[model samples]
Target: MPAPSFMGIYPPDSVQEVHQSLPLDPLGPGAADLLAGDVEYRLHYLLQEAKKFMVHGKRTTLMPEDIEHAMEALNIEPVIVPPRPLPQAPFLAVPIPSGTSGAQQQLYTVVDDEIDFATYLKEPLPPALANSAGVKWKAHWLAVEGVQPAIPENPAPSSRAGPSRLPAPTTGAASLRPSAKQHLTTELQLYFSRLTAALIPTLAQLPNLPGNSAPGAPQYSFPDAERHRLAALASVRSDAAVAGVLAYLVRWVAESINKTLMGATGTIGCLIDVVEAILDNDVLFVEPYLHQFLGPLLSILLTVPLGPHPTPSGMSPSPFELRTRAADVLAKLVNLYANGYPGLVPRLLSTLKKALTASPFPSPLGAEHPPAGRYEGAVLGIGACGVHAVREAVWGTNGDGLGAINDLIGLLYPGEGRKNKAPLVRATMKALLLLTVPKPEGVTAPAPDAAAVAEAFGPHFVRAFEKRPWQAQELMRLRNGGGAAEAEVDAAGEEDDEMEEVQA
Candidate 1:
């Protein structure tokens, strides 16, 4: 005879014993084997169903609740057992028979209860078993007269709906019709409503100042609130939904430009928060509509007066601060995505130059100068282009590049036709310093041409430094070519100290 195939790990003897435990007639041929196989199959099926439950709950480990939920979902009624009290002196220590191992003899015990076995058997069992919560099975119609009832037992509404109620479509074309964009728009609106409501408390902290608590007032806190907003936005699973929200934000900023500074700043801040969240998510695929974002982002960055005009007598961070913030976002986008969109950097540079050099309001004195806010935005945008792009812009890749270095130098030059706004001069100096500084180690870029930079701005460099006295010392050191090395050494020492502190 052939050896029995390993159908499963379930033992046939165990199956036979279970079968014999039940009060039944003689078993048919191969009944034990059939029973073992069925038990194995059912156990495997139960595990597979339990796994679906785990995944549905976004869990890694299987829990008892998962199994319960799985059974509930499958419409399987679970068998529960009532708690029973222990009988007094149920087992008694008894002497083992001779010739048994000492270990076996020590382990053996006998039941001492001597109630009538036949009398216990004659008693009827409870109709329904109780669970830990003392819940008992209650009978309800699984289906009544071919119609499923929507009871707690049958929770699915679609399952309860009868065929008679489900009307058949009269025309195939009508049934096959596509949903309108208005439906999508309505759904998006609802999603945004929920999202805004959920995020408002966390993201929109009102200022504590008196008289600032009016309805729909714009009050925002930095970094913390922004972080909360980004986290909330990133948690959204649908890419298209997130994209729709982002598109709406862009439109919000575009429409809010003429609004109050408080309003425009709040909305622009939200836009930047959303962009940061999208970029932070490595799995989020936004490449397809990335270009669509550029227009709105650039518009915010290049807007001449980013916020409402501040009172001449009042002191606050410049209106250009908003433009600067938006410019920073633009720079990050360029650095991360420049290679993918070849024209992006060039277009940005073109737009920035135009903004920087465009004649300012004609004065009664017949003088024209670019606004400091515009100049700052343009300079920061250039700096954001990374070292290589800046070098190429300065020293042409093919002996002919946009003379960005010259333009910047000309802006910085004292007594030049350009207006000498303190902020504009400071920004230009910072941009030049960024361009001339040595590329950090591990960064593969051609070193800035010290000779070319010196020759270009050496004559007027002192005037630029005197204008920004606070940063002059560092700026002069950098321009003289000794600062980068010193800076690197200082940075290395700081890092070493940090490492030592962490180790200690």
Candidate 2:
């Protein structure tokens, strides 16, 4: 069957002309329509194949090379016609005079070799082949005698010496100083703009209240922003040069936390998600600058007033929650690149302990007391370092580790020291539970002394048990025997799930 004439895809007259040009007998009746239909089908198929080439090249516009590649893939060769020879110019011969000698007679012929009409009439090459300029390889010294020349290839101007030369103090030395904050390059700015635009809708969709929401707030079973975050970070990870952009973005996020009053907490959470996405990409080489991130991560973990002083209703996450998320990001960084950066673990632990134990006021007469959010952040930070980190902190060569644990436990009970705050108490209980839990195989640490922990913090455990039965059951199991039965394990798993829900 033939396509309708209204389609006008392959005109019957053109098909007939093409058939007539071939060196064959005239086609039978209706043969031109069949040939046109076949030609249309093959053209569509070729175009589809050409589009595949364009997509494979990561290009949006189709090119003649794409079409050629498609033809090659299909084992098809296009016909090439040679150009015709140019026409000869007309000649006019002058007759020799009757009186002139035959030997003296001469004739002149006019030729048109300079201008070839056939060359002008021949088909032109495709733009893809004709418009391309030839590449000429050349080399030159980028720098001469430790000074870069002001060439097209060099970035700096000849009038200005490289950064090593000190500017005169009288001539505005302040302007010569390096900027304290990192600035995104033009390319990076564009990338960041696109990524943030892509993420805005997803971020907006996340409920302001993590675990609790008003009756009308939108609800979701999973994190809706996760996919967007992964895609944005994956783009950065795929390009090595963009790694610096990721670092700059991290610093920018940290600065935002310090500068913004409201909504900084939620923004920080999103930034942590970005960090996780980058870290999760195993192909990215993040170890070189991993140390630089420690400062920002520590600041997030220990920064007081992490959220607004007077947080708006259901608009921001709690200070504890923000710090907890920061701590989680820090732990992941440590676990992934700790060996690359020595003393990271100890420095983080020290910073967290100071924040946890710091008093709000200088003297006892002052009415202000330490905020419970800091303690919770500190406890969660410890737990994020994994069970081995917990054991080392509790039984390492440095006695301060154990002392820190004791201090944390002491905060759970009323005493002459800092009074027990509920948030701190709950956080401490969870941290202790994580520390005492049996680690899986392949970890070479000595088993944690559950009985010793029970004896040391028995009264505090009892107090916490009154409020949290799950902790009490675990403590009893640990004291009676270090092993937990299947049922008890299942119950503990359920309790962990509940805790995660509450934390979320």
Candidate 3:
């Protein structure tokens, strides 16, 4: 059926129910319909106003406060409805007297459970525990003058940025900023800075040195900064207190060696001198960082440097000279530190041994003889360990019943001239020469029998050392020393046999 038009819609039955609830007499038939239309229009008007409140508050959902606000603005009394304790309290399906149709409707509402106020007041509140540890403060540098120092407090360069974020050298005002690495003291920083600066060769017009050392006796040159450099090295060798910057100094020298080894003249020797200086410092305990020195030292001694090889100039030493210097350094290092660092000698021996073998570093592609440069270094490295090592390792028999090194030493091809110069032969001769016994205080030992000399050191060794009488005497000394060691061994075996018999 067509119904009366209104601004908003509300159920006619609902309006009549409200009217009936009032103490006033029920509305007339047409009055209920009119009232409903009026009620719907008023509700919609208030809602339209409430919508403004909702829009002003920037909310999509409407609240009871919005309705009340609309009513207040309209000068209308708002309904007094008690709020439920819980927002989501469920409504009950209260039954009413059966209507004409005898049907009932269910209403839903927020419902709350009953609580005992007396028990609630007595209940303890949850312990007030913190969600995390208490807030605290600490001081550390974020970055000093746009550069970070490698201290424990600061993030590591690799982790914070990337592996490429190396600590760069700063100058002027930037350097003045407190950028000490790992919390180094002010004095160490100054000492280290001075030492490094003084030792570094000041590149100038270097008077060209001997183009190359004369074949047999190699010559060496020194840089203009040799005085300051030597002084720096001497100070480093003696300064017990400089241990704090040892790692940095070692790293600096290693990097310098790598940079200069191929072409740059004179710098390689200076860096090595620095290492010797550090080794000389007896008061300082350097055993811990000694391993870091091996790779660079060996590279200078052995490896055929990559890239274009250049002629020596200024104080730049020849390859032969470098190998000699490196061998001496290794020897000195072993003599000083090997006793304390038991494995130091063995580790060096292993690397040197590999270098000495027919096939060394460059694997499967073997050489009849290891490269001349590497072979010379390895021989010196072994001899540097002292007479005892040379005796057992070089002179002693191997799987082939002759020492691997002993047999090879005789095989080195003897050729002369620059490119054909046999440094390997010279090196082998030097190793044997090192074993020669020193002359007694006033008296001298008679020359060894030629037969015995050949017997002890092999015929090739005897021929090699025959250049000088003193050389031959040293050879005899070496033979005598070997004979004495052999006698001792025999005696030891006899003693063991006697002990076994006595026990029986």
Predicted model with the maximum TM-score: 3
Query: Quick one: ranking by TM-score, best first?
Result: 3, 2, 1
**Alpha carbon deviation, residue 283, candidate 3 (Å):** 3.5
Error of 1 at 471 (Å): 10
Clash-forming residue pairs, model 3: 88-110, 89-109, 89-110, 89-111, 90-110, 90-111, 91-109, 221-315, 222-315, 237-281
In order of appearance, the predictions have TM-scores of 0.41, 0.45, 0.50
User: In model 1, which range of ten residues has the least summed lDDT?
Assistant: 168-177
Candidate 2 TM-score, C-alpha based: 0.45
lDDT of 2 at 463: 48
Q: Which candidate's lDDT is highest?
A: 3
lDDT per residue as tens, model 3, 1-504: 233455445878887787778766546567877777877777777899999999999999888778878977898755553453446545766556566786776665546678997777566432221111343234568888999877898867657642222222222222222334435777777777777877764444222323433445434554445556667777897877678877767767776676556644455556667788888887877777777778777887676641114333344466777778877888888877787888877777777777777553341224453346677777777778765555555554321212354455445542223222456556766765544443447765555466765565555444454554565665454355546434543566568679978998
Superposition TM-score, candidate 3 onto the true structure: 0.50
Q: lDDT for model 1, please.
A: 0.53
> After TM-score superposition, what is the CA distance of residue 255 in candidate 2 from its true location, in Å?
2.9
Candidate 1's residue-wise lDDT over 1-504, tens digit each? Answer: 223434668888897787789866567788788777777776667778989989988999987666666666676775443334434544566656767455545344556567995786566544333323355445579898999887888768755444212121111122111232233476666665555543322213423212234456566534444445545666553355566655443333334332323332444454455565566556556576566667766666565545433322322234565566666777778867887889888887887767766655332223354344555667667766654444444324421232443454454333555434445545555554543434445754333344543453543344554544334443434445545634654576568679978998
CA lDDT scores, all candidates in order: 0.53, 0.56, 0.62
